[model samples]
Target chain A: MIDFAKDVRLWFAPSRLKDEGDTPDYRFSLANERTFLAWIRTALALVGGGFAVDQFLPDLRWGVRVGMAFALLAVGAACALRAVNHWVRCERAMRRHEDLPLSRFPVVLSLGVGLVAVAMVVVVLLGWTSGR
Target chain B: MSGPGTDRDAGLQPERTRLAWRRTTLASSVVAVLALRQALRGSGSSTEVAGAAVIVLIWLVFLWVAHRRIRALATGRPPGLAPRSALAVVGCTVALAVFAMAVIL
Candidate 1:
């Protein structure tokens, strides 16, 4: 019987990775890919969220759409940037003896996204109050 | 073990980051289209499209940077890429929030 772990090792050429990290290489790579997928999912969620915003307020105006589009676009770009950084950090930590560089990832971007979301709320309020 | 002379850019990062940025651009484009469709059908589509276009341009810059990184990686000398811009993030959030509010009310 083929050993699944051994087969995977051969397929991925795991030998390319350094052997001393606290985390396993295979697990690390998988985690990196999963992180990328999460970013993609987040991008989709923002898109959907942007779409849904219109449903709640039919009295919509141009400003809200413009703002929301920009916000969602920012969030999407951040997600992709996070994906790239995660891989870079993870790989560097595993492959190079050098210390892993500091990362700002979701830490910095998520907060920015949250604020954008708040802007979304503000826009709703402004539109409703203006009575346009 | 990574052999001697393996710089940071010696691996697949450029390709990976490029792909990541590409995905981001694609998603932004989709959202832009969605916003424009909604706005045009109603009264706010043009604004949404414009805002989204602005965001896309940002991603395009990101894409170019990623490509440069990829080439650096391919050459086996890691290049230092700047961290994500906080100002850009804040601006985008503010823009999106405003757009959403406009549409909802």
Candidate 2:
């Protein structure tokens, strides 16, 4: 928990992340950078999905629409935060020659997306039935 | 066992990274356009207009940064991304997501 607090504080101090240890191989850093960019893109897609659901699903019930859109938006925000934190941790570890950090985020993200997809299927079926 | 010291894949890494940046820039552009569309199509209240403007600014900043990074990678030995620049990119991404959520709400 202490580490988490320090990271939150570090949000305002970006330069400090690179201040420690020697710079690792440029390729490794570039790979890390690309990974960070990928995560950011994923976050953008999720946020886009949120608004798309909100705007495209005019027939969706109000409560369900907002709930779904909010869920997507929340996940997007979380992903954005995770991307930066992971990038910082990876960069620091590389500079210090420590083992790369591990995370369960990919598994969790997949599960969350799966759950949303299932809910979407149910919502679609309900819409079909209600119209008939 | 190829390692970091190996030069067998020289240039490829940076090339891929540059491509990734380009793709991300395109993705962000799409999101920005969508957000703008939402803002205009909605009630067009002053707050929504301001929010849209902020999103546009963030998008432009991100594009500039990504474009700069892409150009840097074209060199034989591109420097590592600055920590501050990494933070700036992440900030723009998060801000974009927040604005998108706001538009939805």
Candidate 3:
């Protein structure tokens, strides 16, 4: 039978995993960690922005309010998930002595933010035209 | 793997990384405080208050973990790339987002 206990330990403790390839410089690994943290903070900022928009902004149509809030939260959730995935990919690549994987996160994130900005503009215009 | 001598010679890499961690933690704390303020200003419902409290608690925990990591780096200890606490912080942040969404909607 497979050792579930060992599998659990490995799953929880990435540090315990054996090194696969030549060790890269500690600087690179530290940099990777810092990048991951930056992404997490970005995600937090998006989430906070979502909450603020929903709470503080004058009430738009129900649909628009909900849509914008969902969009922001969705992007934030996606960013958080990507942060973890990028961290894992970078760690694996470093372990294997492979070139770091290319990340499309910045592009996707900017696109999402741009869409949200456009939506907000539309929302503001709608609110201005409609008396409420 | 960095030896102690090499770590000392590394010329502020660890220090910069530690600072990055601190900055991230500070950002999270700011977000948490904003959330708390929003919750209080709004309906002041129990769940919103609870959610804000949880966020503040999680941010504190993150700061503590970042502190530990900085100390480890200062001592030239290789404390691994990702700590479980970092994962916990991510999880909590995501949860906070979801809770905020629910409250808003």
Candidate 4:
């Protein structure tokens, strides 16, 4: 059984970087990857969480099912894009000797929160209807 | 494993990863359990529930592997390179989309 994580670790080893410094660009980049993985996990959590909603709301219509799934899918897609965005920003920060980007949190958070809001409305309507 | 304190700190990374996977796996497992119930209950009469169970179980296995791998990396044990799981995940997702269509339609 091969271990891809280890391989990834080796592949991104800071020694491979052209410059190693106290600024810790490499460290930041690696942290970026770990954080991105965390987001992916969150996306999966949303998907799983959405399913649990389904179990209780079995009589739910397609809109609810699909709506919740759409929210989860959006979260997943956003995470993937954020992963690339983070890495690129980190790399650029290293080149410019600046801090890694800080703006992504607000953007992603707003997007995630917005989707949850819409999903909640759909769930409420569907769940309420199913109840009666 | 190539920075100040990072050498001594390498152990923390795996712990964090394990924690993330633990949380994710637990959530996914719950989904599986719930999906199984839905399947038995014939909720939506959708094939997605069965698919959910399979996805959850497979993810559980992946989580276990992730946990073990973190430990291996932390202790400086050799990690034989494994193939990327992306292709398989993508395939599972495509299957999921099709199943969702069947379930929802």
Candidate 5:
């Protein structure tokens, strides 16, 4: 049986191992790091939004409110996980003098946020009709 | 290892990277505090409180690691570039998500 815990630990191992590849231009590495940080900030914003919705928003149908909050929280968690993966992949690509990997996170993030926004709008409309 | 000649752009690159790291740490700390406050005020449950504490602790550790990396960068040391702390952040975020769901449900 595979030890999932050990696999996870190994997967997140420090990027200093071996240091085999040539160091690319410092600017490229710094840019990649900055991109990683940007993604982390985005994730943090999503998590904060989730908290705000859950804590502060008035009840617009408990199920819908909870669903919206859950979606934001899940997407935020996903963004955080993806940020580290993208950072490591970009660093490795730079070190190896290879093309950087393409990222689909933007698409995922936009779609998730767009869906949540639509849901909130619908809830607001329903509230207006119901006079609540 | 010091090379014979100093590169003109070396200082700026590390400084920029350090700033990015600091910005990320600040953002994560803000989220952690928000989570803590929401947990304390929304539910007041022991599990939620514990989860928020763990999240804050992880963010603190991340800040410490980032500070050390910034110092190393300033001194011309190669950054370790580890994602271990970043993963910890993600793990804590997942825990926070669970807490949020619990409160919502």
Candidate 6:
């Protein structure tokens, strides 16, 4: 595990970063920053979806309602955390002239979202049958 | 390639990044508004009022951070984002999401 004290220091201090590597091209860094922002927006949208599900779907069974909301909320939180971690890692990679780190996060995220969509369809059909 | 001003022109990368920051700032603002609406929508008790106030405060902090980054990107040769500032932005976002969950639950 990463040293918690060191992680805290890195979060609060700028001195350690200057020694990480050479500065990368401005355009690449800008692109990385934009990517981070995009992920953040994605997280926000997911969280908003969670709120919508909880607030607007009072007709939904309580178990389904809370479950879906929590699922979205949890993914949103994960995305927010990943956004910054990825940004930092990318920045470091660029500075060091190394290959950008790759992860299965995008694939997992897509699958997770697809599963949620499928769940929503089932819930909607169930609600239709019960309401009528 | 030939002239001094040509290199700095560089095809609008900074401009695009600045616009992205602006877009995110607006998006976060909408989220904060939604969270605040949720908090105060019904018979808002004192606790709800306090939560709403905190939501606004966190949103303002995010706005401030984004505004700084946006302004920085307006320059032709913008410096890299400070680590602390990046941490602040992420912290605000995570905090906002947590508060949103709290409001819901």
Largest TM-score belongs to which candidate? 6
Which candidate do you rate higher for DockQ, 1 or 4? 4
Comparing 2 and 6 on lDDT, the stronger one: 2
Candidate 1 chain B: worst 10 consecutive residues by lDDT? B82-91
- Using Cα atoms with residue i matched to residue i, what is each candidate's TM-score against the true structure? 0.43, 0.88, 0.82, 0.56, 0.79, 0.90
Q: lDDT tens string, model 1, A1-132? A: 353343234323433333434443433443454455456547555654666555445465656654565566556545644454454455546555456556666686678778876876876667543365
Docking class of 3: medium
Tens-place lDDT digits, model 4, residues B1-105? 365544444445545544654664565455445445544555544554556666566556655655564565454223321223222222333333333334434
Residue-level lDDT of model 2, residues B5-103, one tens digit each, is 544454599889989999998988887887777778868788878887898899899989998899988776688876667777878877866776666
Interface RMS for model 2: 1.6
- Model 6 error, position B50 (Å): 0.3
- Alpha carbon deviation, residue B22, candidate 2 (Å): 0.3
- Candidate 6 lDDT score relative to the true structure: 0.81
Sorted on lDDT, best first, the list reads 2, 6, 3, 5, 1, 4
Q: In candidate 3, what are the lDDT values of residues A11-129, reduced to their tens digit?
A: 46766544556567777778888888889889988887877777666556667766777788778877886786667667767878788888777997898899888877876766642
lDDT string for model 6 (A1-132, tens) is: 464355456566667756788988888988898898899899888888887888777787777887888898889888988887778778877878999988789999999999999999988877632242
Candidate 4 lDDT: 0.49
Q: Which candidate is the best by lDDT?
A: 2
lDDT of each: 0.50, 0.83, 0.73, 0.49, 0.71, 0.81
Tens-digit per-residue lDDT, A42-94, candidate 2:
98899888878777787778788888888988898899889888888888889
> Which fraction of the native contacts appears in each prediction?
0.08, 0.77, 0.53, 0.14, 0.63, 0.65
Backbone collision tally, model 4 = 4
Report the lDDT tens digits of candidate 3 across residue range B2-99: 66475463467778788887887787777777667766765778876787777677767777877788787776635555547557667767876776
Better of 2 and 6 by DockQ: 6
CAPRI band for model 6: medium
Best by DockQ: 6
- Candidate 2 segments whose C-alpha is farther than 4 A from its true place: A9-11, A128-132, B1-11, B43-45
Candidate 1 lDDT by residue in tens digits, B1-105? 566786444345545654554564455455545555555564546666675566556445544554554464354443333223212332343344345445545
